[model samples]
Target: MTQTATRDDDVAAGPRASAERQGDVRLSLQGVDAFYGQIQALRGVSLEVRQGEIVTLLGSNGAGKSTTLKTISGLVRARQGDVCLEGESIARLPAHQIARRGVVHVPEGRRVLRGLTVKENLELGAFTLKDNALRRQRLEEVYALFPILHERRHQDGSLLSGGQQQMLAMGRALMHGPNVMLLDEPSMGLAPKLVTEIMRIIKRLNEAGTTILLVEQNARLALRLAHYAYVIENGEIRMQGDAAAMREDASVVKAYLGLGD
Candidate 1:
């Protein structure tokens, strides 16, 4: 079973502060279907992440949440639908191509390079960019958001604590100035304090104009940060609505939030 983290003290109980920051659809998956060899992972999954919005996907383990993200980032090719970025079809593009188009995926497990310095790992994220000046500018931006990474810029990426690695993973994605980011299970395996810190940073990222599609294990925390949400179950989207509404939903409370009087 997938373990879920509870909301930090700072995570509020209602609508996110950035609820009004939504814009036109920045990314959309229309009836997307994906498979691994013979096993179907996503069935007619459709969703949207509007510009400047923090949208989250909530579900249990093996509920196709990660697969939905993979499909958007082109890590998993869609067998029968469209993955559109700003109204352009990108379902058939390769993962690298999708990333170059500013669809960054910060997958689960942190995935920091074992031997590379923190700076090098961040530099890898900017590989798609050709301008040296722009790369340096982005590096500074990342450092500003994660000062610890700046302190350990020369240290090995794999040597950082789990929380720091999560920051590095997120900071690395920001290196390219992504139009839309697919964050899968970011708060997994984190201590409560670190989870609070990560969620705060994620909120800051959204407030700073980054469009995010988050797949989080902490439903209450995810709902707290998100402007809107979707709940996936058994390879399909079972529910979607404004984040505030879902938080008060009896079904959501019982199944995901575990809240009862």
Candidate 2:
């Protein structure tokens, strides 16, 4: 099926199809479908992240979790359905255009510039801005949030530890001044201690008023930090609800989260 067709299916299947709407939503994905060649990667995945809330998308590998983030960021164009930022459709916008609209995507693998200094990488993030003072101001803010990057400002991003590189990636995204941050596997490739540290950062960012749409394989941590969440499987959303409720759901606990009954 095409992107639009898939999105339509998602709208029909979504749990909230008949629920009474409430609160201000920041990002809304209605019936979004994505494909890689002939194989469908995402099938009608509908979800929402409300203003000032941390919403987690939890699933196993190949469950279309990353595809969902890419579609929302305009890195992968949806074949069907709409991706709305505050109720305005952005599906057709280019990736850079979408970024300009305050939707910053920190992709999986923490794609930091290995050759550039931490400060230089951050400067590149503000390329869309013309005002030097504003860019410098934002850079200071990111440095403040991640003091290690400031301490190693002159060091190349490649020289930082994995945890520090992840922090740098997040700081680079923040330099863009996004209203909604789409984080894909922010806890990937980290030790248990580092994972906890990253999760704490996610929570802290949300608490400080940044709306986040987090995709994670660490379902336990994701749900713990999220206000609302969706569990996606085989390119479709299998379950969704308040994060606490999902944590209590037997299927969610046993399957995606690897928790005992």
Candidate 3:
């Protein structure tokens, strides 16, 4: 379910308020190609996320959405391509080095550490920070963003509900004071109410000026929330457009948005 690739407008005139936040390019991937053993996972994939904008990558399962995120975060190497952060090439950097550069990846399935207390899991995210005062300040900020986590600070992260775990995952990422957040399926497997809550938090994060690259299967929601979007299939970018145009695209509505089924 891919439409012909379209260019993303410099300014997204979408209904989302974040359109006004779009600024200089914060992250860019140029002609990226990746492989897992003998299997190719990404084929000349290219995309860019602007400062203070929420850009969504849409695809079904195994469409390389997660792989794309991994590549940006340096968890998966780009076999042939340029992954740049603010005009500097980071393609060859190690995962930790990339993290130090402010690219945070909140992986799918809410990978919260089961044995660690909720607070402990969050503190681990600030490992790179050397200043205790800054770390404490960041911790307070995360707690404020998620009061439930503060309430459950003593409890193991895995003991929390699905939504709570998702909060914990996001809280952990926020601790790093990330420049760009690559969120993979933040809404997966949550109840409808919880989904709405998570989406609201994501919106809040963006409004507070965190650049985001969101990979979501919920096309209707993604299109509604994002400033811009890219659709990929079989490891190739098949479509790209501002969210407003994408929501109105007939092929996109039928395929990802579940219309005309």
Candidate 4:
């Protein structure tokens, strides 16, 4: 059987889709089908992110990477299947509600509000919060995570460098105290150094207790950082395995990891 039809028996597949594994699944997408005006973007995609794991979804552009994150965050409706968070169904919930429930989607583009100051943009992230004190506390936490944000807190978000803007985007998402973060193409358009920096920050975030579902086109980076990975093609899952194993596969090397001759 294909790995998608069942778990990878050779290596531990973490807790996301494993019924026999311990602890709770932070996010579960089962047979999830998403459509854009009748154009089916996802073909029964199923995956799992266990509590405190970094799972990556790897695919080329237009391969339903962003759509999958959008579906989980409720920006797009699922035409079929179920999305459960800690065992509760959220497939049909609205985007805002999904975010409030601790599922935050940091979209591909660094969509920071250009007109807003760094602090203002981060404040917008806590829109679900009513307590000013708690919001302030969360904002401080985000600033600590991305210290450059604190350095530019008074400047307009657009005035920051690309890497700083990306930091602001992540800081904004952090304000929501997200249990699970759906990050799309975080390494896009960044310098090689900046990409390494951002990936390091992502690893730190997961180490600090946030489950991550990463959508990335950088096959080498994704395979290096992900504990487990799912490869999708034309809206369907094509392969899956332990991230390290996938990295070593001959087909994966030729097709995705840029090691092909």
Q: Name the candidate, 3 or 4, with the larger lDDT value.
A: 3
Stretches of candidate 2 off by over 4 Å are 1-22
Task: List model 4 lDDT by residue over 1-261, tens digit each.
Answer: 001111123222233333243346889999999999979999999988888778899877788888888989998899999999999999878888888999998998889897999999999999889999999999889888898899889999998888888899899999988999999888777776677778889878877888899987666666767778888888988887777777768787678534453
Q: Give lDDT: candidate 4, residue 56.
A: 92
Q: Each candidate: how many clashes?
A: 0, 5, 0, 0
TM-score of each: 0.93, 0.89, 0.91, 0.89
User: Considering TM-score, which of the candidate structures 2 and 3 is the better prediction for this target?
Assistant: 3
Instruction: Show pairs that collide, candidate 4.
Output: none
Candidate 4, residue 151: lDDT: 87
lDDT (Cα, tens digit) per residue for candidate 1, span 118-237: 999999999888999999999999999999999999999999999999999999999988999889989889988888888889888887889899998878778778889988888999
Kindly give the stretch of ten consecutive residues in candidate 3 with the minimal lDDT sum: 2-11
lDDT of 1: 0.87
Q: What is the C-alpha local distance difference test score of candidate 3?
A: 0.86
Model 1 clashes, total count = 0
Query: After aligning candidate 2 to the native by TM-score, how far in Å is the CA of 91 from where it should be?
Result: 0.4
lDDT of each: 0.87, 0.81, 0.86, 0.81
Give the 10-residue window scoring lowest on summed lDDT in candidate 2: 1-10
lDDT winner among the candidates? 1
